[model samples]
Target: MALKELEVRYATKRSRDYKLADGEGLHLLVRPNGSKLWRMKYRFEGREKLLSFGAYPQLGLAEARLKRAAARLELAAGRDPGARPDRKPAMTFEKAARAWHEHRAASLDPGHAARTLARLERDAFPALGKTDIRAVTSADVLAMVRSVEARGALDVSRRLKQHVSQIYRFAIPHGWADTDPAAYLSDLLKPKPRVRHMARVGMEELPKLVQAIDAYDGEETPRRRAVTRAALLFTLFSWARTNETRLATWDEFEGLETAEPLWRVPAARMKMEREHLVPLSTQAAALLVSLREISKTGFVFPGDKPNQPISQNTMIYGCYRMGYRGRQTVHGFRGLASTWANEAESYRPDWIEMALAHAERDEVRGAYNSALYLTPRRRMLQDWGNLVEHMVTSDAGVRRDDVEEVGPPLTAVA
Candidate 1:
């Protein structure tokens, strides 16, 4: 007779061992040591196999029955119960993300790579870190994206989608899973809000900004003041990105072998991934020479911590201190330079873009190009700087036309 619950309980009390038969090849074994185990006997691939259903009592009879039902359903669908690849051990999403990051670490910028990894560790890992990769569905990914979006980290959510997509691609080639759940993430992501800081500073505001930056006194900390001052000036003259300038290392700058004792930025620090030549004007080169004495150890703008560059926030705080807070942004320096060149009419747009290390986005045009617009860009930067310098030092030379004629020049008076 098939074992009943009461008979099994009696057997356990008398002989300290009991066996209960669950219909359709399932059985429960309860031992004297109070251990219960679920086992399924089945045929697959022309062989008989016993599959363990995990610990009993801990999993409970109901849970064990549910697992048995799932296995039976698989068999009914003509799937092999023993040869099931889906049941094989799989990695958690967090583990997959790490594995993917490791493969591409060398190709990414250090700052960006670190931040990406840290974000995943903080946001995505705790909830889904332990789940098997193959078992994770599109719904799971959508849920994670929504969580990030709800927290007002929409940009992060977008980037996380890209990161997860890369992970899925990595998983596909490895035979881990057949589908990329992250593929649909683009449609699921919330649209990014328009940021108002995209505006470029007008020519009229350029001089006042320069003058404010120049005359502004920083904190009592001499190192802080000097570094902040240097960063502002470098932004004006170099037209480099905020991070590129702030993170400058002493090693990236090499004294030129030519006339004005210029300092060159290396390929790695530059956005174009190519070495940049900065023909330092007298004032610019002097600033570099002065900085070399104080910043001789490591970074040109070393933080309070040894060997690290000043935080990006330092330059931002300096902007606030100089009274250019909401009127402009740290990234506006690029716009100011680009706008000034456009208004000058003598400078080439491509030359300005090259100076800022922006490669032409037009793929066909970019593929055939290899020049770095050194001379024209240098002249444009100098001309722009001269205009700012002139306005800051004296008010008499300030031209009202510089501001009025900027975007679309009103038809020049006949």
Candidate 2:
């Protein structure tokens, strides 16, 4: 017979342990010490097993019955209720974080994913790893963030908080956590330091820089010098980042001998993770033609090691050799290009931004604008290339007429 609630409450403890049977393998085990525990007896594969549902009154009669019903459901599904309960293992902060990282890593670049994991391991794991993710309070998160901030890594602290918040955000949907402890941490962190822009030369000084690059002879071999000059010039003319140009392969270039010469940068190498189209001008095409004749490796600018691209410091060292140390950077060429184009009345700002491969701020607009301004951007870059060529070939520097000429019309080239 099933035990009644009043009987369960009024049941007396005996000298030895005793049980009041509830129906269907569920019973209340009342001990001599005045402790009552809910237990269940079930058969799985001809073997009897016992499952505890906690102390009586705490689990209550109705809840214990529900547990029995759930256990029977588990048995009906061919699973052992005693061995494998419906509840999963407690989710710790580190475990949740790692799970989140694994889920996030699928869409991220390998290097970026590695760095994110490294940051979590370095800043978050030591303090919060073993703590239950649901139990982690805002104060607990703040303490960990403060520890990082104490070491003067304000930026790291900020990123750590963001990572923690993201972990919680990832956990909540899966029922691992109920609250995000790191959500309010952004306001608590120290203000970031002032922004420092990369060093770059002014437009007025561009002619002298171009002249210096043309006459550059710092490399031991003439062939090495040619490689350096071509690499730098290509970066400048294409308005591409130094790393993009450094990692360029011959296969990325197309239609070199034709009118519509192009450099198709793959999305993997790009900073924004989007493929960029660079319409190679007449001068830029000529540089690639020269590079092809002296190509040593797959990389357009082969580094010291075989099958490797040029080092990050290679172009920086080239700028240093040109006596522009601390005055200009290889990356600064894009800034100069942006400044020149924005100041020019002929070029559209959107076309100039597209040429620079800057990400559009609006997601919907960015999706719609992908490679949409190609024709106008091509003309803008071609005009910029003409101005660069004029500066390089002329001793008198860039004149108004030269900037206005931009060689022949788009029809003549295309």
Candidate 3:
């Protein structure tokens, strides 16, 4: 009997490598690491022979059968199916994208590399992955951009275009193709009116978000529940971007035993090659101290998998479970903090921007320890953390009584 697609797919790896038969000398070779490659056996010129037909799913059952029939035909004609001198490997988009991603990822940071490939897998692969690199036309690229734009994500459309261009740029040097089809379509795309902002809840709506987070126990494991709570609360207190928080290491912290603790983000890990100094608030410092009792490695927030950082998606999906899927991102906490600080006007614009690790008005400034006012920034962060704690636990949602108790500090944050 022929092998069913389901059986071929559901086959699991064993301690030792093994194979599965499909009755006509066709077999699925299963490696211990779970890779399944298709192979066929036959006899030619009074000698028993075997031929590998490539990996399963990539070369399916029907295609394998066709190749087998063709091989038999060639053998009957006294020609060799096992060897083809004229054959050249197909230039598939998957092939080129893998090559490009590998080469491009080397020059980029770990976080950016992971995200770029993820987009390729999700958006680009299904449509163009198998297409020949040289055969892809501008029309094909247009359809892809239009498909994403139809979903109302103009930013995603732009990113897809940029990644495609990079892939083609890589292919040309490697002798895969001539010109980039995606490059020609740049003129056709309408410029986005403004950069889309990360979704964030206003002060009036914050208590509901906090209540949902506090009530969350997570669906699967105890670690999941604990990680969710710690990550969410840390984000609320520190107001850092998702990736920055998720990939945080224990070595990045300093002065945790003192009243003025800080998180020193290294340049290589940052978006730009500039060091960012984050003043740890009283609550923020406490969270780190609690995390210290259990962490076995340098990772402040360890991942579910051994020797891995906490996943960026896991942090974002915490709110997805809280029924704020489209209304809040992990970075939304930063947006909320930015809004509150600017509105309060207790601190100067430079102080708030510096605290956020954003560029200064001069665009080229001294390091955080020298130029930016650390003393004032520390006080600003503490004030913000205190307000956030009140918001998280308050029942009346920062009503008149809550507002009256906390006033901006009398001393100027100069």
Candidate 4:
């Protein structure tokens, strides 16, 4: 008999089992102990599956019907809820973001990834992260971005948009959300203004700057003195990105090769996403070898913790100690190299691009090849390093009278 609510309610607690069918594969089972339970019978992969809703009147008739309808829709979409024999409960954005962080944290320099996630949690998660992934919309994301923009942190707001887009993309592949709202809001959000690269110090100013750094005498703070000297020489010889070479570790380096020892930075740490072999001239190698003796613990330039590389702010403090306030920065070293390297025709345009880790200008070649030009790059770096060493010691023979030419390509065996 088709069971009604009143009939089932009026039934006294008898020592018998009763079966009640609600059609469309849903059934309610009333036990002898007066407990009512809901269950659904379905088939998938040629095997029968049973899904339980909950006990009534806890779940109630109306709620159970709604759940059954949703389950039927999932079945129609070819997803079997009963497929996973050991399914865990859903994870929240905070949990997912932490998991993403753990995997990506060590790839970059210290604390960058962690700081990014902390910002996301503090500014982003509070608004929409707690809500179920599927429930978030474009409006929700737009509002969060607008809030950041209102704070006058335009750069941060722009970055937040990218981070949120990454999170959304992360969520979509993991079945958390359907679309990335931030991806659609690019035109809607304010565009960040272009920032000019720091100007390279001119030849006339270079001598004065070098003289100032050389003549400066400060208290014997081992870490401060060593790191500052290292930064100055590193800027000259390496001619690589200040941030890239700043996070150097003992494990990453290989000893001097032939005339000048070349330090090969692993592809993982490089901005180019390819292995970079840097030519360490006599001056650069001497600086590194000396630094190794003092900072033998872990990093080449150890920080206050004595286990990590020197802090990013150390260069600023070093500049202050050197009696150069509002002069040039540690990063200004790259500008010096860039301007000089570009002026020299001996350096191939491609070699300069590779050294800078810039992508290939040729669309056809860039599409097929992503790795940086390593072979000619090694020679170019060596030439650049040698030039810097020559200039430092006031060697007139080291004049830029000749072009910077790359000798041959270096094949990395390992």
Candidate 5:
């Protein structure tokens, strides 16, 4: 008789092992220890064989019957249902992709590598992960791309296709795949949107913005407020990206007490994947000293989470708190610094570019100019620091004219 689900559920263990047959070679093997295992008894080539279809509850009755039906089909085709295939198992798409990611991650930043793996797991894995690398058709890849695009994530969709193509490229060289299925998928995606620059205050308004940042006390604890304030000031004074500043650690700094304090940003953390040197001015170094007294984690601006730096939005929200939302961004400080320094005749354009860490276009020039202008860049930053300090100490509603009258001249560095 075919066993009812209730009977399977209520079946109790006896003092020994026993079998409850559901007919057609499908049965439940109930043991004395209250374990229910699914097994199939069949004959192939005049020889009797046994196949295990996992355990009960996990395998369930209907799924086990499905497995039995499939096994019967295999038997009809003259293939052994329990025997292993002669050839090796094919490499799965997930396996090939993970191998590629591991190889690719060595040259990538740790955070970037983690985000890439996360995108794969979230989007690609569910659709094509278990399929054989060679068996993944272009249509299958397109389906995954369209699924992401349907949700208004055109950028993610485009990047997903790129990553898929890269995976195939990695696979083909390893003999895991014969062709790149994702190679021609670029045209199928939507067009990329235009770039919009971040908002920032003009040179004339910088002093007022500086004053606002000084007075910002956005409903947080005194310690949290101080950390956010210091993060913003450091980013402004050094003109480093908020991402670089937020992720900074104590060991990245050197010679803080000396005349030549430096922040050595590791190659992995930088946008161009090259080591960058930020010459810290006295104001920037002083902020670090104050941060060291209250900082509880390894990060210079530690967040609420354990051992993690503050979020990239910490400084952005600080700007918002000072009523500058949509008028300024944390990254705008770089533009402001560039404009101020470039307008001044004393500061060299290359020195300003190096201070901003903009990648030099020519490779040979980039390599040759890597350490060429540290001294001049340091002098420029010190002048910038002095200007910022002067603004903070001056009147609350200070203007460009007032700053020009009382502060160090913009061209005073040279």
Candidate 6:
């Protein structure tokens, strides 16, 4: 059953591929296509595995035996040479993902860098992380993307797909990979899902909603009720995102009691992972002043648990309670302010955009100064805060006593 060089060269093609024995699990596979290939079987980690040497003729019997002996040596030393780190077979998706992330960590904002890994762990890693980078097919990458897509996270799906593509491209020059499986993946993508911005409300609805918020009496605990109200009002007055609002700490606020107040949201807390300065309107600063009284914990809006930030869903449910659940969102306050300012048309659009902390189209302008449009923004926020007070205090066909309590005594969804 031993494979001889002359005999293997003359071996006839079979209806199906058959192996010519060379003992020790090494064999010459005679394919129907008249090709002779060398292969060996071995074991590692209590599992049987296979390794390829080379094609016969080019890899004669003596050389094949040498390669097999080397492989067995590697196995005895507790190594799988078949999947060595230098080889394509050993390059795992998780390993490559780590490499790609680390390669750009220095340049990327820490928060963005952290989220990229977090997302890969959450969505891609569980499915294909251990798979060999070369072994991962386009179908494999698409399957991972579709899982996110099925949840209707269209933007997340797109972002994750781009990440997969980047991973493959990064691995290519490093020699751990050869093929770009993620290339041209968008062709296989399902129909574009609707663009879903965070749920937020317009100006006309802002006032009526505020009136309902005032009526929210939570179990008659005045401190908790007051904290909740202040949190939402603070979110509006600062035009900060829910996470920004909830996680805000007293130390981050400067000059709240002074003539000029500023809430400096650090890069770690921002979506873009950059430092943002929020010019506090009198109302916003006043809310923070009141908040400091009740909050012994550093977090401006402490959660039910001590010292922790408030639940992200707290304000959304507050909206739900006010019978404006669908009509308004905690984030909608930003949109409302934007709407009010743009309609005012008195301020420059760039200044308004800067106030909103939108990523500036001009990179130079975006990164130029943290307080690029401070004076005008202070005035804009003051005017907006005045509008908010009028909306909350004035009767806009919504009586305070008539509004319902927060979505029925349910535990706040964390």
* TM-score-better candidate, 5 vs 6: 6
Task: Tell me which residue pairs clash in candidate 3.
Answer: none
Give candidate 4's error at residue 341 in angstroms.
2.4
Q: With candidate 6 superimposed using the best TM-score fit, by how many Å does residue 225's alpha carbon deviate from the native? A: 3.6
- Candidate with top lDDT is 5
Is 2 or 6 the stronger prediction by lDDT? Answer: 2
Give TM-scores for every candidate, taking all chains together and pairing residue i with residue i.
0.54, 0.61, 0.49, 0.52, 0.55, 0.57
Which candidate's TM-score is highest? 2
Could you give candidate 1's per-residue lDDT for residues 280-334 as a string of tens digits? Answer: 5444555565566567467777677777888878877888887767767778888
The C-alpha stretches of model 4 lying farther than 4 A from their native spots are 1-120, 130-135, 149-156, 166-179, 193-200, 207-227, 240-249, 256-282, 290-325, 345-370, 393-414
Question: What would the per-residue lDDT of candidate 2 be over residues 1-414, giving only the tens digit for each residue?
Answer: 988899999888898667899989999988776878888887789855567787878889999999999999999999987663565448889999999999979887676677789988987899889776765667778989999889998867877887887888799789776446686677788887886777988889998888777656567765566667678878888998988999999999998888789899887777665677888877777677756665678998877787887788888889999999999998898899899888897888778878888878675687576464767777888888888766755443322332122222111222
lDDT of 6 at 170: 95
Tell me the spans in candidate 6 whose CA falls farther than 4 Å from its real position. 1-96, 109-111, 121-137, 147-156, 168-180, 190-219, 258-260, 264-277, 303-305, 308-328, 347-379, 389-414
Off by over 4 Å in 5: 1-91, 105-114, 152-155, 191-196, 211-228, 240-252, 258-279, 294-326, 338-414
Q: Per-residue CA lDDT of candidate 6, range 1-414, in tens?
A: 676678878988987767788898798878777878787876678655566677878988999999999988988898976675754446689999999999989987778788888999999999889887766767678888899988988768877888998898799779776556677787777777565776666565666666666555542455556667777777777788888888888899899888799999988877666788888887777667655656889898887897787787877877776677577788778888888899999888877887877877675666574556888989998888777776554343322332221221111110
* 3 or 5, greater by lDDT: 5
| Candidates, ranked, TM-score | 2, 6, 5, 1, 4, 3
- The candidate 2 region of ten consecutive residues with least summed lDDT is 402-411
Ranking by lDDT: 5, 2, 6, 3, 1, 4
In order, candidate lDDTs are: 0.67, 0.78, 0.74, 0.63, 0.81, 0.75
Overall local distance difference test of candidate 5: 0.81
